[model samples]
Every structure is written in C-alpha cells, then in structure tokens.
Target: MEPDVLGLVAGALTTIAFVPQVLRILRTRSAHDISWLLFGILAVGSAMWLWYGVRVNSLPLVVTNVITLTLQLSIFGLKWRYGRGKRP
Candidate 1:
C-alpha cells in the first residue's frame, strides 16, 4: 500500500472510532458521564492540530482532524448541557 493509502486507512479508522460514541450519545440523548475537562482538552488539541495541518497544507491531517474536532466539539456540547444538573 502507498503512503497516501496508508494515511487514508489510518485516518478512516481513527475518524470512525468516534462514530459509535457519537451515535450512542445521540441515540440515548445523554452525555452525563463525559468529563468536560477531558473533552475540552481534546477539542483544543484537535483544533491546534487542525491549524497545524492547514498551516503545512497536509490533506490527511486537515481532513482527519477536522472530523475529529467536530466530533469532539459536539460531544463537548452534549457534555456541557447534560452534565450541568447532574452534579447538583
């Protein structure tokens, strides 16, 4: 397999890894157990990686991280909304 092909394969796998979690959250309509700190770090880190990908003009990095960042942010949104009242 070529390098690009390998990258795509890896990207696809990592990208899809979040799918089940996202689906579960959406299906159940709950994110009560998620940690805000963890998701915040993930979103910020992924956004930085996205910026880096854009800076270096790397297609795989840009594409993979874009999806990752979006997923992380969405999870974060759910985490925030659903996690709020549970603590009290």
Candidate 2:
C-alpha cells in the first residue's frame, strides 16, 4: 500500500478514537474519571504532531492532528470544568 494511504488509515483510526470519549463526556456531562495527565499529554503531543505534520507537509498528519487537538482541548476543558464538580 502507498505511504499516504497508510498514514490516512492510521490517522483516521486514531482521530475517530476520540469520538467515543468526547461523546460520552458530552452525553453524561461528567468527566470524573478523566485525568489531566492523560489529556494534557495528549494535547501537547497532538500539538507537536501538528507542527511536525506541517513541517513535513503530510496531509493526513496535519488533518488528524488538527482534529485531535481540538478534541483534546475540549476534553481538557471538560475535565477541568466537570471532572471534579458534581454532575448537573
């Protein structure tokens, strides 16, 4: 298979992986179990990956990292806002 194809496949899988967590958080309006350590690492890592993707001009990497970054930031925010407080 082509390298780009592989990258796209990998990117798609990883990017979509965040969907469930995000959805659950949104649905339940709770993030009690979510940790800052996990989301923090992910946010920073995704930002770095996004930079790397831009530097290397990899479309799959750039697209997925951008999306992943957004999702991660949202989760981070949710973690801070709802992870500790009682559910509403």
lDDT top scorer? 2
Model 2 TM-score is 0.86
Query: What's model 1's TM-score?
Result: 0.84
- Highest-TM-score candidate: 2
Residue pairs in steric clash, candidate 2?
none
lDDT per residue (tens digit) for residues 1-88 in model 1: 8866787778889889778888888887777777778878888988998899899887888888999999988887776666655654
lDDT of 1 at 11: 83
> What's each prediction's clash count?
0, 0
RMSD of each: 1.8, 2.2
